[model samples]
Target: MEAANLCAIIAHVDRVSIGKRLAEARDAAGMTQDSVARAVGLERTAIVLLEKGDRNLKVPELVQIAQVLGRPLSYFVETPVPAAVSRRSAPSLAHASTRVLDIEIDQFALDVRALVRLGLLSGAERDARARVPRSHRAAEDAATSFRRRLGLDSQSPVLNLGRVCETAGLYTFAAALGESGPDGACIEVADDSGTVGAAVINGDAGSGRRRMTLAHELGHWLFGDAYDHGASRDSERMISSFAVHFLAPRAGVQKVWSENSNSPIRDRALAVGVEFQLSWSATVGQLMNLALISHAQHDDLKLREPRAGDYLRLGLSWVEELEAPYLSPGFMAACLTGYTEEKLTEARVLGLLRGRLDASQLPQIEARSLEDLRQAFMGHGG
Candidate 1:
């Protein structure tokens, strides 16, 4: 009787711990109790009870909740890891709509943290960062330093920005932030174990714009400007400087400009834009900043933005480079490892892939227990 009572007490303690974790994960996901309850097919009251340790959770129910929360089952069953989030969004998007994306980006970072915990991913490397550039010129210089740091040639275009970012230790992904939301948002989630850095660009934006936004967010992550929220106009300008220079270094721009000196300004802008994978505005703006074009010339060039046909005529591929259903290489690798090792379910793997793949695309494997039956089907008699 005494053992039964002790076991009951331990179970109660476990329930309380799980309840606390549920609440934390819900909060991290930016989900309301009512919303979560609806997704979990439970009453709001039930969710409240679950989060308050006033109710016991069935395994199936918990699994459903975990899926709804975009969390791994281990996240709830194991001891909770401590996490602190530092985030920044475009101040222009500091409204209700952006909050939805804020949740999305935060969830991405938390997912990366979960992968780190599982020894499948590495956390943020604070040691890799240098001091934040203090001025616009400094930011520009830092951009050059960044090129050197990444082993990128000063005159080379970054063909694969997503892969490049992963090389620099920042996980990058795309999210549907809609037309009115911020261009992108970056987050750093710190725990006792380490910090996980992630950036989510607005996939709905134009491909060039998405690439520029990603570079802007990469500036934020590299400089530890996690919580700026674009509050300061000067700070925003500095980051913009970083982004422009990072994407199209001044030396690269000059080289391209000189190479196309005989071309019309529109053609020249298009050439620079295509080569650097920059938007027309960014390309022209960089030209103006370099004093290669007068203010009047900049205005005239900006007015005549190149169309898709123009790029096609130039033999440039008009691929949507930063389109959605995009996952970072590292994140995808971790998901594959987790799934193949039977540590993650097909649903969870699909969820993490975010439409990059589907169920039919997963590896086909007969259960080990059914191997003999599989051999019989293959006509290998035992």
Candidate 2:
């Protein structure tokens, strides 16, 4: 009985410690108990009790909390709590209200890193990260540098921005973050040598928004030191400007808008969209930022959405494709590598792909004969 009592006492103490850590993590994440509860699908009292060690805590629930709070699972489950949790005085809270969408992005970055570390995702071609300079005109500098390095003229459309970013050593993925969530988010991963090991972006936004989101997220990575845990309005605007210029250079706008469409602002913006694959409003805003369009002219153009057949009428050819792999690049590449190396079973690969893609979209990989490769690569050497 005494031994059982001592064991009970130790268990009770552990619970108390977990409760304290939970409370601290919640505060640091700048979330209220209610918000955390809502995210974890628990009632407010449940969160309170869990934090106080009065309620049972499950592993999955704790993990969900860690994700919602942007705290690592290790932070909660690992021994020897961090100093921030152990200190007598409460550490200063981060931004009191971060968009939950950003928190989801944070989790996405973590998951990608984990997958890459586990060899479930390919890390090939990851060393080409840009050495971006910091300055007031950082966005402009980045835009110019990317164009020059990639041999892209201002008018050249980024036919595949997702592949472009991935080739540039940024791990890009898209997820349906819901309408209320942010269109995108970026996180920077690095090593002790100050090398950017990996960068991640959530570009689940629609085609137009996805392009802009990729630029904005890349801007955050190139200009800022690291991911901004507490991004402010000004910082958002700055990166937004970078995105605008990166996707639609001043010269490109002038060349496209001047050649065909020159009248009302809406018409000019729509014309830019047709040429650039950008949202109409963003194209107009970029023109305004570059002083190509005056405020009066911008105001005069009625802001409206694209009607049906707008792309066909405008000669935008890329829109006809039913689906593009913006969100599945990393996973797809990893699955391919695994299958080719015989590291993963075909059933596993198909099952995983089915989650991210339609069953019909999944491909069957068969070993190609040397003759087939020679014919494919050497054109039969005729």
Candidate 3:
């Protein structure tokens, strides 16, 4: 393509991928072009130029921008660019390997939402209007009210925590949000690092670790919401506390322990793990938080942390065989509002799904059926 045409194509892709208006989605999604530019390793002006169809972009550059936008590469070229000149066919490009478990995690989040809407669970997104408090107590109160509004008992064990998060409008993804931050974050998935889920469990971690990581991130979403900008050890602890309370409420843990005084706290913890479908470490954390186990006991248990891989394996098995589909509310919202693959593809070429996924991949998937591409990408039986 000619230089001017290339620039126009780039601008058009940005408009579609990011939405009709780049400024609007960026503002609404709470992002700055500079931040996005930095994430994509481009000059700030380059972002502006690209957004305005004034910069000529190479395919590789387009791919980087798409990653920043939280979209696949197929998003950019499937329609406007003629099929004869397309870089690659949709199925071949879609077949590029991804972490299967990661895709499963994203799909799981989606299924969870489906379950909630089906009346299998109850929850809601944290109000975008609620005042985020600096005080710990205030944050807790806000979190409690959020729980109550979602019809979740303050002290009830969360039977399906992941499902609860999806019902709250988070887009769970397999990709980690980088190393500097916590295991995951709740930022605007597309506008930020393309992460939508409560947390991004490190793809490299064993399954059990991923599960804990997910719970940890879920704690953030439940308490911190999208307004909280950064992650910290203190914030992590507070969210951990929130996760414990949500999973094994103080009252509930006390009630269980009261019935098993003769049983060792470790044994009690194990039982709680089974009853609440939480990890044993999580159960122990609940005991420590509730003062049922002494600090020394808590420390001892911590010294003998259970293998996260074991827990992850069991959890995956359960999710696949017994648990219902975990759908994402965000995906549902996008689908319901007519944000189809074709639309996303248009955005990709224009640089809208710029920072989300590889722009090159967008065209491949956009030209192919999502189901066919999903099967090729994931090797999923269905």
Candidate 4:
């Protein structure tokens, strides 16, 4: 039979037999339904229902479950096993499906895989209190706390958001297209694209725009928002605000501005760089919140066109002719490598790594590779 037909057969067999067949498959493999549920974030009861043919299943969910069971979806279709048995340690399934690239791209898929792996490995069990703040003030307050946790001084200079994301253990990528979907997205191996770590930014945009997009996506990841491949403008605004506060805390910006009232807002923008809109807006908002700037000045500034040119010029000087780190090769390499290493090892052991590596593209490495591998194995590595 053709591979596709075989896969369909497997899926059909699993469904018709009321999960008894599935339970036997699990038993033969020595895996519990609970384990599969945990891996996919489904309820244990749902697994029982699935096995018993009592619940209808979506194609995607069915595919995922079949993958976890180490058979093609068609396997379930062809031969339904009885539900009485259980299994242990079923083979790991690919995390996502494969699709033709909707857009042409550059860069290694392995690196992409690595980034997804790192993101999963570094995934935070978000605190309930980490909800998005309502007002700008609340947002700023949260930013301050977060910055403190990172041991950053409020006034410390920041440029190149990709670097910031890398530091925070996020996997990010720049894409040439600006599709109608999200500025970027996080996905597991199970998504059709089968990418592990990726955040697509508008590659056509200037460096400044790319930085903003990176920060925006990182904000979603950090804030623990459910992954939405298509985020709305309002969601972008909220995530943008979160990024602003995350990068430039209110108190520090206020203190710096207070020390130098004559410091041109233009200069502050320059000092930070082109991606400073959110930071600048947040700073001005904080001043207004503290009753420093009048309502009129705030309104005027908000209405003003952003001085992107001015900020770029000033920011360039501060960096002593070195391009922003986000634009640097080292930063990109570190981010891609760090994320890939973290994810592949973690997700593989966790049974989350899916898909096959294109061995032809795998890189030759040094003895340090072993050291790095050991570090990740111990969970002490990035």
Best by TM-score: 1
lDDT of 2 by residue, 1-382 (tens): 0122333343445666677678877875678999999999999999999889898776667767866875555444434312212222334322122334343344445444444644665453322344333332776767877777777886666666766666555656565444344565555543222222232333344566667777776665565433333554466566677677777877888887787664655556677876677766787677777787788876654355667476557655435210222444755677666656656555445433434655455556679889878877787566
In candidate 2, where is summed lDDT lowest over 10 consecutive residues?
81-90
**Structural similarity to truth (TM-score) of each candidate:** 0.74, 0.61, 0.49, 0.46
Ordered by TM-score, highest first, the candidates read 1, 2, 3, 4
All candidates: CA RMSD (Å)? 7.7, 10.4, 14.1, 14.6
On lDDT, the leading prediction is 1
lDDT of model number 1? 0.75
Off by over 4 Å in 1: 1-97, 127-129, 227-233, 364-382
Q: Please state the error at residue 201 of candidate 4 in Å.
A: 2.2
Q: Could you give candidate 3's per-residue lDDT for residues 118-196 as a string of tens digits?
A: 3333444355454334454554565566577669775565544455666665545445423322343333222111233
What is the overall TM-score of model 3 with all chains considered together? 0.49
> How many clashes does the backbone of model 2 have?
0
lDDT of 1 by residue, 48-93 (tens): 9998888887766877898798765555554322322223324443
| Residue 31, model 1: Cα distance from true site in angstroms | 13
Give one digit per residue, the lDDT tens place, for model 4 in 192-308: 333223344554444444555566656655555543424443554566666666655555556656655677764543343322434345545545655666888777665664554
Model 2 misplaced regions, further than 4 Å: 1-103, 119-138, 191-206, 227-234, 261-265, 302-306, 309-328, 339-354, 358-382
